[model samples]
Target chain A: MAVSQRALEAAGLGGGRGRLERLRQWREQEHVFGYGLILPALVLLTCLVAYPFGMAIYFSLSDYWVGSPGQFVGLTNYREILGNDVFRQTVQNSFVFTGFALTLKTLLGVWLAVLLARDVRFKRVLRGAVLLPWVIPTALSTLGWWWMFDSLYSVVNWTAIRLGLISAPGPNWLGQTNYAMAAVIIVNVWRGLPFFAITVLAGLMSIPREFYEAAEVDGASSRQRFWHVTLPLLKPVLAVVILFSTIFTFSDFNIVQILTRGGPVNTTHLFATLAYQIGLQGGNLGQGAAISLFLFPMLAMVVFLQLRYIRRD
Target chain B: MASAASVRARRLRAALTYANLTPFVFFALFPFYFMFVTSFKRNAELYNLKAVPFWIQTGAITDHYDFLFRRTEFLIWMKNSLIVSVIAMSISLVIAILAGYSLARLRYRGVGSFGTAVFITYLVPPTLLFLPLSQVVNWLGLSDSIWALVVTYPTFLVPFSTWLLMGYFRTVPREVEECALVDGASRLQTLLRIVLPMAVPGVVCAALFGFTLCWNEFIYALTFVSQSGNKTAVVGVTADLIRGDIYYWGSLMAGAVLASVPIVVIYVWFLDYYVSGLTAGAVKG
Candidate 1:
């Protein structure tokens, strides 16, 4: 109200007999206009994100299934999930998957970005092709990988055998537990690398050429320039990309669901896929919600750290 | 002699650069290449492990494409994806434009916190919300309909587009709106006539990104829509084409290729906007 009143005054709606009354009216009008403008988005967010989020929290605390009403149960859902071996395995799997994928994506992304930032023929074409894994839908692309990793018809094994690198067919990529996990991680890395590469390339391109020239004039070697200047300048962008990718990969459902379906004794069940398996498929809404939320605290911390970094920048 | 040495050095560098790039290029494009070639192989060629798997040594066939259109619900899935994406795009665009304008230009209370709220909402991953959202979809009686996606997609889309558009709207000169107001244009009129026209690029960027996000969305579509005919392309192809122990490799690859074509076409055409939109959104956050 105070801000709106000041705005009304700024707009010269303050000039009149009974000026305070006119100011109030104008303030009210501005208030209405502002809220009206934002109402649709606000309402949609409230209904979709906020309400469901609240419901998820509640569902995690109760004994709710799909159709029936849930009764309040204090810490029972969390305790049960913690005690469950499958739940423990899923948590470990998620961390392993996210850690491996993020590390590979960052390393590969930086290498690719540096290469792309160079003057090369067919750079645009290469960049466009690099983005295919990302631009296409994940499930569809993962399906292709699933076929490539198929035990009987795997092209990878065929290539390997044809090249005389292996005497027998390649290992069953998705049949064994460890192999299944590797397959999903490989697909995740493949899908996410383009995002990292493209974003980091954008960051690299924005680095002022004058900075490099100055470093060169000071007799700085290429490694010294990269360590001293490029890394420091690229920190903000790198932080944002890493955090974004971490959150995304941690919550990833598509690759795991489409490729292995968290199979071979539940070895590759990510939190999201596990949640869907338990909560939706098994119809144990309460336990499913609890499993899904196991990573909420970590996500909140990441979000908090990211917001702080954003503010500092 | 010096000139010859420098020329040799340059040639070596060029050769080494291309050699280094070979792995990246192959890693990026091989899956699609495999998918394309596999889509053309006959059932016999597909199952034959003795033949060269990398290329179609035999003639290409359209049997998979024929099966996809004539056998499965691929077309319905495509139509559903288009409808849901378009409607979701329109809704998100309209809401985002207005909210972004308000947050950027309007002097109002709680604007800062409201903007932050929107950003935080963008960070809330769909994994946490999908279960409860499924329940909400059921409650709204939109469980198996495309409308479920149409309404729920904005959960992620609006926040993102609003944040993107807010950044764009802030770059719009304030004087343009002030001039419109000074010329006795109503606020709504100023927004409609002057501000919106100026923000067309931002709007288009937001719309394109929104559409792509909607199209690529998977979990919600999988959870909410159980019926075969109601699935989106991504969900339908993944869920329907693969049966137990018997993968329809040809038809599945065909579906994958076709499902990808629309968004791929748009991405290639507007590659610049898509790249900028992604990086800009990331950098702003």
Candidate 2:
């Protein structure tokens, strides 16, 4: 009784404390509705994301063909995949695709971002124009490129030959293994640059003008200012953008599958497409899942490290 | 004079800017220009190995568009895409607003931490999730329907939209809501009557993003829908153009151009939303 009385006196609720406590409780409940609002979104996320992800991991370890019962394989598939040449090549190709695409996208994105940052006439139109490739459905725009590169109907070849730039007629772009891969990479870089540009542009705009003015006052050259001022300030957002693009480019199936579908003797096969062939098309679910699951550990480690970096502020 | 020297320096800077931009402009514009010119050529003209095939030679060809529309399920595919994108956008945005409001304003235990965790979940690549998702779709018996996309898109869309809105909601002043609360309004009423009106720009941004995501998604649509009538615009164009052994180049280009039109229109309409939403919090940070 003494403790309650003391607490009431401290809170200024000793007299008519019951009514005061009820009003406070009601106010607290009212604010708690904020928590109540997120319930539906959480339910949807769990159902569609969390549950499916758990199922994918579970099925990756099992020898489950699509229509048949799954059996525990106990790393047997993983062991076999380690010995497979095609799977190894697919892994290598995925790395090459991601590596080359990331390098190109970042470089080009930075270049374009620098240009767009200048005070120019009709900059908005150019920015919007640049985003068209990124915005259009990957399959559709890639198909447009595919038709442009088709040996039989290639306007590029026809124009080149007619202009006397080449002696012979249309070159086989898709048929040649090397050219096919290069074409896909080029298309991927083209589509990705705008997104990188937009992101980097946002980053550039965010930087305070005071920094540049200070650098100018100190007689810093343009290159030095960019290297020291722009680069360091843009680091966090750039890290997020690059990490996103790397993960995306690594697992990209649409551009490759649309353009080549691992064609001309599987020269362009990446891990994701190979998984699709094995699991869905070729009907070897266990192997396909195993191939798809191959990149998970590496990605998880990288992403885990990145998450730490992002949270370390 | 020092003024003349400064003028020369200004010109030098301008020249340097031009030099830096040349490669980027050419690289960005060339292929699209190539596509635009190529789509106008007949098969014979395209095969002729000619320099600068005038796209509007005798007449700007309308045959490809006609053929694509008449010969394939292009119209139906377009309709399906519109339906799915609209429905998905509407559902995700509605859910996102409620969820975002709760997370931003509510002081429940774990709410702050949970908001960050949810945003991270949005970054989970659809590539990794699509395999198990196929099985989930099979279980739900929504295989080969546009409805499958509508159902699954929110898995990804809701997270990002909610996250985006949460950031936006944080900017809205708390006093406005407190004023509403003092006037005998409930939380829901305050959100609808007061908060949403002020948050229209943010809501529009979320809606635009949701719409674009649903419209452009290809992997899931390709994986899920195989039927001729139900395939979304992306799948329909690709599959129809390369049906069996034959590749119809003209019609495919036509379909590509047509498919891009709606996106262009949407972007133009909501240019402000794209700019603001895209640059949201970036400048401040």
Model 2: chain A TM-score against the true structure: 0.85
Best-performing candidate as measured by lDDT: 1
The best candidate in terms of DockQ: 1
lDDT of 1 by residue, B137-250 (tens): 999999999999998999999999998988888887988888987787778888889888888888989999999999999999999999999999999998898777574899
What candidate 2 gets wrong by more than 4 Å, as runs, is A1-32, A152-171, B51-58, B244-247, B279-285
Label model 1 with its docking quality class: medium
- lDDT of every model, 2 decimals: 0.89, 0.78
Whole-model lDDT, model 1: 0.89
lDDT of 1 by residue, A209-302 (tens): 9999999999999889989988888888899999988888999998998888898889999999999999999999998999888768868877
lDDT for A94 (candidate 2) = 81
Report clash pairs, candidate 1. Answer: none
Give the per-residue lDDT of model 2 (tens digit) for B188-275: 7888999888888889898887888888898889888888899988788877676555435667777877876788789878876776
Model 1 lDDT, residue B262, Cα? 95
